[model samples]
Target chain A: MATLEIHDLHVSVEAENGPREILKGVDLTVKQGETHAIMGPNGSGKSTLAYSLAGHPKYTITGGTVTLDGEDVLAMSVDERARAGVFLAMQYPVEVPGVSVSNFLRTSATAIRGEAPKLRTWVKEVKGAMERLNMDPAFAERNVNEGFSGGEKKRHEILQLELLKPKIAILDETDSGLDVDALRQVSEGVNRVRETGEVGTLLITHYTRILRYIKPDFVHVFSGGRIVESGGAELADKLESEGYEAYQTKGGVTA
Target chain B: MADNTPAGSTTDGAIQVGGPQQPIDARVSAPASYDVADFPVPHGREEEWRFTPLERLRGLHDGTAVANGGGVKVEVSAPAGVTVETVGRDDARLGRSGKPVDRVAAQAYTSFEKASVVSIPKDAVLTEPVTISVHGEGGVAFGHQVIEVGAFAEAVVVLDHTGDTTLAANVEFLVGDGAKLTVVSVQDWDATAVHAAQHTALIGRDASFKSVIVTFGGDLVRLHPRVVYGAPGGEAELYGLYFTDKGQHQEHRLFVDHDTPHCRSNVAYKGALQGKDAHAVWIGDVLIRAEAEGTDTYELNRNLVLTDGARVDSVPNLEIETGEIVGAGHASATGRFDDEQLFYLMARGIPADEARRLVVRGFFAELVQQIGIPELEERLIAKIEAELEASVA
Candidate 1:
């Protein structure tokens, strides 16, 4: 089983005034098959933590120790982190004009799996995964994420999450632009990967609507730069009705 | 290149092959000649010569460069029912498609010892492509080529250039009535080689002409492709792809003259520049005269600057003298790598360099596929990959 530990993480972004700290002394730990939901209002350093963990060049880690099964995660390159079983489903999927979805998925699979998958079986696997996500088969030939709708882009992200099958899959705001049906389909795709029980999931969102479908074992209420509250699944239901007004102040409350 | 069949029959907003023939009312009787003195020398200040580096011409423009060099070795492979011949300048078929419109072209016309003419007979269909390999044997050389497709014939002609030399030449295409032709001209010269050529074509009544120019190597290369309609219902498509490396300058100037009624033309050119001092230039010009009613045309040019110190100047101009045209438009774009695209690919586990390569390949994929020649397409893709590999090594 994989274990990801982020201890006292401090991250900053280049702002007009200079390096502005976004995540200050935030800590979280997720084990194999664990579903951790990070919920907060806008500008609460939620996405910053996600991007920083993915090693985005825009987000600088001022002080942090991120490890996966005792292996240094912060020291890895973005692609290296992915090869080391870390998957990031970005909030906004990028459009690659000429690279077809099939090619991109194959390349990514090759990179992560350390070898090119057999062509016939890989094609079938892709067809199966796409069918599970309700994606059109024609999408395999179209350029990656180009001209896709908001819901389509989110579904594509989940498509990658299923195809790559990383140890820790981070879905940042995956439900933002999704409709009720699309959200259900995407959550179903994620749960299929979760059923393998070999993957840990970090679900970052602003609403508890998605929780009704993919239940999170742990709920962390993020505020300012760190988590202001931590609890079990019941905490999500509590925040669902109570809102984050109480946690907006400072110093989290334990469950 | 999956479907290498010609594209004119299927394109929308583009003229279809074969229709009723009509008179050419906007034709200009150009002073066709092999005399360099008939054309005035360019001072690099003229509109056509502005972007060209004068000194880089190696005396080809000023009547100083002699054709007494080792010259180029030309080889031709023609299918059955085709003919290839070397004729003197006085051959009746010579200069029928077009004449030298500029000083450099006139100079080339006057300098070449003989011209190679490849002709496809009427109603002939070549199952295999006609290949012509032109390798520079060193020094300054001037040459000319004429590819004539007969009525109701179909053919593909490939002009392959390689080796080193300072060369200038003129090429002409004569598309007969109801004929279809696709010509691919590849300029793969040495790093020190300088090559310039002007390609002219005359589309016949209900005929289709497609030109694909691929330029990859050369210290300095300038090519001008011009097309004019011989009668109504003619069609023309011009496609070009180039890669400019460090200290290299590649320029493509195109002029499509809609001189007849119901004629159509489409132009698309894409280029990539890498390394310090690398430069690329694309000038697309389309003119529809007053008498050319029902004229349809569109042009597009796009460039990718792969590194710092690289520059691209893309200019697309369309002039319409009549309001009776079906369509007229042009576009130009030049940009570097899309960071978000790179990030997306890398986030999926592909290495940074691999992602960059994939992006570049995608940028040119559409145009390359339109070439419709499988072997040539594969070679061009591999060449592009080799170029990217060199940047890191």
Candidate 2:
């Protein structure tokens, strides 16, 4: 079982003018087998929280304490955090030319598992995971994210999420460009991992559509770079109908 | 010396050497000749020698380096039906494909004592590749080699160069009508070696020619590979990969002349440079003449700069005299490592050095696959890994 605690997290990014704070003293905690959906409008600093937790150099953690199972996650490097079982399924997966999908997956598995996976079983495992996502077997040989459609890229991210089996998985806008069918397929993948009961998922999105498939244990209304309200699944239904306009008007948040 | 104009002369009054004064061809200014005097010594200002370090050539340009008998040892092994012979310079089959176009090549032609010739008989399809190993012992040496495939014959040849020496050589490939030939030339010389070589191939009617040039070693290595078609329907594919390390200079200049109608050609070269003073140069030139209608050609060059102080110069030139050609295109790009790419790989738990290795290896994987030899391909990949290890350590 793993636990992620983010207390008073303050993140800033360098803009043309100067350093601008994005995450303003946010607090959140996620335990293994728990699903947390961070609902927000545009520029609500939802993705900023995702990348900052992943240790992106662009986001500076001005003041925060992020710990994973009592380890200083904020002090660890991006790769070290990954090896420690923190996975981020990026919104726009980068295109790595000439690197095949099979090689990338195997290398990642080796890094996390501390040894290369058994070749025979690993091949079957990859083939099975890819088939579960309805991905073509030929996709394994193609370069990562190179020439892949938007839906295909999302499915690839979910495929990694299923295979890496990280303790804490952050899905950043995984449902942004996905269609209805792709959304259902991707959500099914997340739900399969959720059923494992050994992973904590932090699904960040602007729409409540994904929450319909993967029910969140808690829904947090993010506004002005911080979560202003927290409630049960009923809160999501409320926001879906009432929309984020109430929070923006109450917090005087622009966009 | 006064009568001979400098090779770099661009003045209107500068006279052409060893030939009657006439309008210079825009494509190639210098005329081809077997005589060393016909080509003047390059003074670093000439277009061809601008990117080269002439002082490191060890006298290959000025004709002062005498042939040291044991400088290089040549060994050739062919299958039973193939003919391999060491013939004198006066052999009638010598210089049949193309003449020396530069001073070093002309000097090599005038200086070499014995030439090695490998011939594949008509209608013969080789099951095994013919291997030629040139081991540089020491001192200065010049060499000439010819590989000819008979009509309808298909053969693959491997030319391997190793050891240390100051050497200039010329290689020719004569692909007969309807023949298919694949050549792999590897320059894995010692660190102190200096090498300059010209590789020319003349493709016959309806023939196919493919060449893979892999350069990794030597202090200063300049290779000029040229292709010319003898008849229409001939096809040529040239692929090259080079890894330049600290204080090394590697240059590859290619020319594909589509003088015949309905011919096709494609050239692709990729290189990686690391450490201080590591330099790489790629010049690709494709010329489609007026009579060569329906000609299809494309050339591409890409370079990966691994570290600071490494330099890459990539120039692609395509000249078409007639619009009746099928297509003509060229592309060149030199770039440092992409940060997002590194981040993407590292975000998956790969270390920084290992991620760099993966990206660089991926960059060259396409060209390395063109070698078509499993053992050689594996060895090249190993060499690339070793090169990466040096920097990572």
Candidate 3:
């Protein structure tokens, strides 16, 4: 089983004025087959934590310890983190103009799996995954995320999640901009991966709407770059009814 | 000191402007004279010669460059119904497609001993392509070649250049009515070679022509491609792809003159540069004359700068003299690798270097497919990977 442990993670970004801290001191852990929802308001460093774990160069790790099953994840480069089984479904997936989805998927699979997948079987696997995600088969030939709709982008991220089969996946705001039907389809894809019982899911979102589909085992209330409160699944119900208003006040657990 | 000389001449032009802007009239259209003596030697001041280093030309711009006996070794492979002949200068078909607009072109036209003419008969559609390979052994050389396709014929020509030489040559394409012709010119010379050439295409009524120019080797190379419509309903597609390495200068200047009604043209050129002093220049010019109503044209140039010191200059100009034209537009973009694109690929487990190579390959993939030759496309892709490998090494 794989476990991702992030302790006192402090990250900063180079803003126009100077280096400003985004994640002050955040702590979280995700074990195999578990789902942890990081709920936060806008600009609460939810995406920053995701990008930092993915080793994005734009996020500077000032003071932190990120380990994947006792191995130092902070020392690994972006691709190494991926190879070591840490996947990130970005909030904004970048558009790579000339790379087809099929080629990009195969290349990514080869890089992570350490060998090229057999062509015939790999094509079958991709077709099956795409069909489950409600994607057109012709979408494989389109450029990666180029001119894709909001719902399509979310579906593509989940498609990669299923195909790559990483040990730990941090889905950052995958629920946003998706319609009701698209949200259900994408959540179904994520649920399918979770059913394998070998991957940990870090579902990050602002609203608790997605929690209705893919139930989270642990709920963490994040504010000002740190987890202010942690509880069982009932906390999502509380956040759904009361919102983050209780966490916004200084040291208020009044709710 | 000449009384009729324009204001932008040599030192005066360089000192007065002191910038990248060119004088209005100095932007060369078609010149009136094709004689070698008619065009004056450039001092790196004119718009066309501004990016070119004059001394590196080896006297090709002036009349001093001569065709030594040790020059290019030309080989030709023709299909069953094709005719290959070397005609002398007095042939009536010479210069019918275009006149020499620059000093290098005029010098090449006046210096060549004889011109190689490859002709395809009317209504002949060959299954096999015509291949011409020009290998430079040594010394300086000048050449002139014309590939003529008769009415209703369809042909593809591959002109491959290899080895080292200081060469200046002119190539022409005459596509007859209802004919389709595709020409792929590859400049794969030795790293020390210098090459200058001008390509002209004359498109007949309802005819179609496509030119694919690929440049990789050579220390300095400059190519000028111009298209003129002989009748209405002509269509032309000019696609170019080049890889510029350290200390190499590769320039492509194109002009598509829409002088006939109902004619259309499209130009797209993509390039990648790596290492210090690697320079790539693209100049796209499209002019629609007053009488040419119903004209449609668009040009695009995209450059990917792979290293710090590599530079790219992209200029796209569209001149429309008719308000009745259908459409005219152009775009030019030069940039480094998109970091977000790299990060996205890497986050999916592709290594940094592999991710970079993929991005560059994708940048040129569209133009490579426009070539319409699968084997050459694969070879060009391999060449691109090899070039990227050297950069990392």
Predicted model with the maximum DockQ: 1
- DockQ numbers for every candidate? 0.68, 0.55, 0.60
Listed per candidate, the RMSD to the true structure in angstroms reads 6.4, 7.2, 6.9
Across A79-154, the per-residue lDDT of candidate 1 in tens digits comes to: 9999999999999988775678888999999999999999999999999999989989998888888789998898
Candidate 1: give the clashing pairs: A228-A252
Better of 1 and 3 by TM-score: 1
Interface RMSD of each: 1.0, 1.0, 0.9
Looking at model 1, residue B146 earns an lDDT score of 92
Residue lDDT tens for model 2, B1-393: 221112221111121223222322333436889999988888887777888898898889987788989779999999989999999989999998898888899999999999999999999999999999999998889999999999999999999999998889999999999999999999999989999999999999999999999899999999999999999999999999999989999999998988899999999999887778888888887777778999999888887766667777777767777788888888876666666777888889988788888778888988888767787789888988877786643
lDDT of 2 at A14: 100
The CAPRI class of candidate 2 is medium
Per-prediction TM-score, please? Answer: 0.86, 0.83, 0.85
Q: Give the per-residue lDDT digits (tens) of candidate 1, residues B1-393.
A: 112111111111222222313212122122435678876777877666777788988899898888876868889999888999999878888877777777788889888878899999999988899999989888889989999999999999999999988889999999999999999999999888888898999999999999999998888899989998999999999999999988898999888988799999999999887778887888887878778999999999877766667767776766677788899888776656555667788888999999878777888988988877788789889888887897632
lDDT of each: 0.85, 0.88, 0.88
Measure candidate 2: CA RMSD: 7.2
How many angstroms is the interface RMSD of candidate 2? 1.0
Error of 1 at A73 (Å): 1.7
Report the C-alpha displacement of residue A139, candidate 1, in angstroms: 2.2
Off by over 4 Å in 3: A12-25, A41-44, A62-64, A118-121, A237-255, B1-26, B43-45, B62-71, B77-93, B120-128, B150-154, B177-180, B262-264, B293-298, B305-310, B321-336
Q: Across residues A1-255, which tens digit of lDDT does each residue of candidate 2 receive?
A: 699999999999999999999999899999999999999999999999999998888999999799999999999988999999999999999887667899899998999889999999999999999999999999999988989999999999999999999999999999998899999999999999999999999999999999989999989999989999999889999999999989997755754
